[model samples]
Target: MHLLIAWCGFVGAWLLFAGPIYQAATELEEEGFERDAFSAQIDTVEVPERPSPWWWLLPPVGYVLQRRRQTEYRRRIMAVMTQDQLERMVAFANTATGWLFVAGGAFFIALKETWELAEVYELSVLLFVLAVVVMFALCALHTIVRLRGTHQMLARSGTARNRDSMTDEPPATSDA
Candidate 1:
C-alpha cells in the first residue's frame, strides 16, 4: 500500500503540475511565440531565489500524522498490556497503517489522465479521505480485539488456582 501511494502521488504530481507546464510551453512555441528567448529567460531565473519544494514535504507530514494517530489509538485500545506488548502494537500499527496512503496515492495518479482534471482531483481527495477513515476503523477494531484478548488472558490467569482450571489453555501464549 505504501508503495502504491508513493508511486501514484509522484506520478500525479508530475502529471498534474509538470505535464501542464510542458504542455503550455509546447503550445506557446507551436503558436509562434519567441521560444528561444522565452526559454533563455526561464533558464536565467535563479533556482535558489525561487520558492522551495514545500509541497514535497506533504507526504511525510501526512505519514507522520497518521502514524501518530494510529499509535495513540492503538494505545487506547490496548490499554491493558505490558510495556513491551504495547510497544509492539504501536510499531505494527505505525508501519501497517502508513502503507494505505501510498497505495491510495498510486491509484490516484494512475487514473489522472483517464478522467478530467477536476474529477481526478476529487477522486484523489476522496481516496485519501476514505483511506484515513478505513484505517481508523480497522485500527479501532484491532485494538478492541486485542484488548478483549488481553482481558480474557488476564482473567484466565487470575482464576487459575489449580491445574484443573487449565482447560482453555492453548499451545502458544505469546502476548502478540
Candidate 2:
C-alpha cells in the first residue's frame, strides 16, 4: 500500500511538472505551424503515418510508431524555435530534471528509514549521488557554454573598440 501510494505521488508530481511544459511546447508548435514555419521543411521530413489500430496488437510495433511520431514532432518544434528560445527551454528542462532527482533521492531516503531496509538505504544513497552529479553536470555545462559565448562577444567588442580608437585623431598636448 505504501509503495502504491509512493508510486501515485511520483506520477502526480511528474504530471504537475510536465503538464505546463507540454502545453507550452504544443502551443509553440501550433503557432509555428500557423506561421508556415514548418511548411518548407515538411517535404524533407520523413513523417511516419499514423499506424493502423491493428498494429496496437503488436506492442513493439506500436511503441516504435509512437516513438517515431514523437521524434518527428519534436524535430518540427525544434526547427521552429530560435536559439535563445531553445536555450531557455533546455535550461527549464534541466532545472526540472534536477528537482525530480532531488525529490526521488529524498523519497528513497525516507522509504529506507521507514522500512529499515538495507537495500533501500543503498538505493537511496545511489539516488542522492545521481541527483548531485546530474545537477552539477547540467550547471557546469550551461555555465561553460554561456561563458564561452560571452568571452567571444567581449573579445570581438574589445577588438572593434581598439580599431576605432586607433583610427581616430590623437589627443592634443597642452603647452605649459
Global lDDT of each candidate: 0.50, 0.58
Q: How close is candidate 2 to the true structure, as a TM-score?
A: 0.39
Winner by TM-score: 2
The residue pairs in collision within model 1 are 1-103, 4-102, 5-102, 5-103, 8-106
Q: Give the poorly placed runs of model 1, Cα more than 4 Å off.
A: 1-123, 162-176
lDDT for 55 (candidate 1): 36
List model 2 lDDT by residue over 13-113, tens digit each.
Answer: 44443444444443443433333543554555656677787878999999888888888878876886778666766766666566566645554544433
TM-score: model 1 vs. ground truth: 0.25
Show the lowest summed lDDT stretch of 10 residues, model 2.
112-121
